[model samples]
Target: MDSSDTPSPIAEPLPYAEVTDPTYAEVAAQNFTVEEVAPDTHVLRGTCPRCNAVLEVPLVGNVFHGMRSIRDVLRKRHTKPSAGDRVEPVICTCEDAHPNRPEGRSGCGAYWTLLLTTEAK
Candidate 1:
């Protein structure tokens, strides 16, 4: 198997920038992948569609009910609607240093909400 032949998750690297936009959330929804690390616990992993930096947001508690209110999701849910799915706000917490990024802050300064689903154990 040739590693070079494998497709990268991020097609191109984007320079870090400190900004937040709802459009980025739409792109992020497509980029993120969900992984169940434990019972009722999951992690949303993906690359920032804005800055192309890696991101991971942990989710705990009831996936559908206790995560966030539907009203909040509606406000932050910039992406297409997914019926019966829970929306969780995700922020870029990547450790990579970006130029001009504020001190004490991590990642490229991007945040978005992702539609998450739960499966019976």
Candidate 2:
């Protein structure tokens, strides 16, 4: 117990940056996919392209969809997508940034991108 305990600290949540550095060798880059639930709702799931660990980001509840009609769609889902193209900002925020560094687990902070899809949608 210290004097600092009396003053609580408030800070931003984890996954601070929207996207991590791509050049870094250990940035835990991930491959993300967007799932359109309804018309304006979506869930972004990022999986390490070559490893285990999945991060799901939900874009809904009138935050990004602050104002949307029931008929709004993404026009076109990602077609012929590449990891480097459709994916940009990705980071590894798994398990409190992996302080303990679990074994066999890829808390390694590497980087990846979306899977390359070659199809006409």
Candidate 3:
């Protein structure tokens, strides 16, 4: 094919998009690995499916770190996972400054639920 006939390659990084698609989260979970960092804390390390930035989630006792600490404090409520607790929610808290991110939020606005397996925890 002629050079001019080929599609132009992208010249810039994709702009940040604020999305909460479950599919993105599902893809992310596939890349995550859970490790017990402490007796009471387990951390999930992986890359963000939406932005491809490294991200970490810590499960301290019954709490997942960084994901909802601020909101729980502001609301004056502490919610715990229900019995069995087979699934935990996760959000991208990647450090890269993605363009168009909201004023007070972090990550690329992607969120998803992570399954807690017996071997992973």
Clashing residue pairs, backbone N/CA/C < 3 A, model 3:
none
Question: By TM-score, who's the top model here?
Answer: 3
Residue-level lDDT of model 3, residues 39-59, one tens digit each, is 668777788887788888887
Q: Which residue pairs show collisions in model 1?
A: none
In candidate 3 the C-alpha lDDT for residue 43 amounts to 74
> Best candidate per lDDT, number?
1
| lDDT head-to-head 1 vs 2, winner | 1
**Any idea how many clashes model 3 has?**
0
Model 3 RMSD in Å is: 9.0
| TM match of model 3 to true structure | 0.63
In model 2, the runs with Cα more than 4 Å from the true position are 1-19, 23-30, 48-52, 61-93, 100-121
Give the C-alpha miss distance for residue 98 in model 2, angstroms. 1.0
Which stretches of model 1 miss by more than 4 angstroms? 1-17, 64-85, 117-121
Write model 2 residue lDDT over 18-57, tens digit each, in one string.
Answer: 3334333122222344566776476666554323457665
TM-scores, all candidates, are 0.62, 0.32, 0.63
